[model samples]
Target: MKLDEAKQKFVHSWGVLGSNWGINKTMAQIHALLLVSEEPLSTEDVMEYLKISRGNANMNLRGLMDWGIVSKEIKIGERKDFFKADKDIWEVARRITEERSKREVEPIIKILKEVKNVEDDSDKAKEFVETIENLESFTSKLDGIVKKFVKSDEHWFYKNMVKLIK
Candidate 1:
């Protein structure tokens, strides 16, 4: 494929993956644009590139910044701010992982852990409580392992995960 085609394919695939990972399509497209662009992009650039509204651009930019995946750059003599992606793959993946864990997993796990502590063991409740406790313990351990694992270098994280899987 030609360079332009390749880039288009990448942006499309990345946008789809981003959707599955809890980000909207235009936001992912904007990020993909920044990822492949040779230079930082201004808010207007992103809005034009993705054909999104200014409000949409601003909101997604803030969301990206919150996840530490994008940052604003100040250029000399330019009143407008430009945005750039986290070019490092590991950092990008790690930040996404951390954000997803905090946004999606933490609350469900907290509720499960709390359920495990409920004191209503009368035969049916006994089984319910026992099962919940087991699941809570298992998920808690897994969450801890994820926390520890994400802190490691990508190579180390993969090595440890491979060994644990084996």
Candidate 2:
């Protein structure tokens, strides 16, 4: 297939993947575009390529920046602001994992810790407390694993993963 067709397919696939990961489709599409780009792209360039409105492009670009995957670039002698995605896939994965762990896992762990304390002496209350404790334990472990993965080097992680799968 042509390069343009391949890029389009990749962008669409990434958008779908982002949606599955609880991110906006357009935001992922923008990231895909920037990822494949040889140089940074301006907001107008992104809007033109994606056929999106200026506001949409700007908003998604900002969202990508907020996620710490995309960054703003200032080109010399250029009036428009340009955007670029972090080209290192490993760093991208680590950042996303760290952010999700903080946003999702940390909150669940905190809530579980708070709710696991049940003062009632009844059987149902005991069961409830036990269940909460189990959940808290599991989530805490998961959070720990995620934290380790985020901090580990790519080679070490892949080697350990290979060993586990073997």
Candidate 3:
């Protein structure tokens, strides 16, 4: 296939994968477009290419920036803003992992900590406390692992992953 065809396919596939990972399809598609582009693209360019509205493009671009994967590019003497995706795939993965842990895992852990502290002596309370404790234990471990992965260099993390796979 041609380069354009391959890029379109990749963008579509990435959008689908991003939805599976709990991101909006349009946001993922915008990220995909930025990732594959050789140069930074303006919001107008993105909207035109993706056949989306200005509001939709702008909203998703801001969301991507919040996720720390996409960034705004300010050009000299340009009124409109351009955007680019971090080209380093490992860095992108690390940022996404960190963000997901913050947005999803950390909040759940906080709620578990709060709710597990109920002061009662009934059987249902005992079972509830036990369940919450187990869940807190598992989530804490998962959070620790995610933190370690976020802190470690890509080489060390991948090396350990390879060893585990082998």
Model 1, TM vs. native: 0.89
Off by over 4 Å in 3: none
Candidate 3 positional error at 123, Å: 1.7
TM-score order of candidates, top first: 2, 3, 1
**1-166 per-residue lDDT for model 2 (tens digits):** 9999999999989999989989889998999999999999999999998999999999999988988999999999999999999999999999999999989999999999999788899999999999999999999999989999999999999999999999
| Ranked candidates (lDDT, high to low) | 3, 2, 1
Count clashing pairs, candidate 3. Answer: 0
Flag regions of model 2 displaced more than 4 Å.
none
lDDT of 3 at 24: 94
Candidate 3 clashes between residue pairs 3 or more apart in a chain or in different chains: none
Task: Supply candidate 1's per-residue lDDT for 91.
Answer: 88
lDDT of candidate 3?
0.96
Q: How many backbone clashes does every candidate have?
A: 0, 0, 0
* Reference-based lDDT, residue 140, model 2: 92
Model 3 per-residue lDDT at 121: 94
TM-score of each: 0.89, 0.97, 0.96
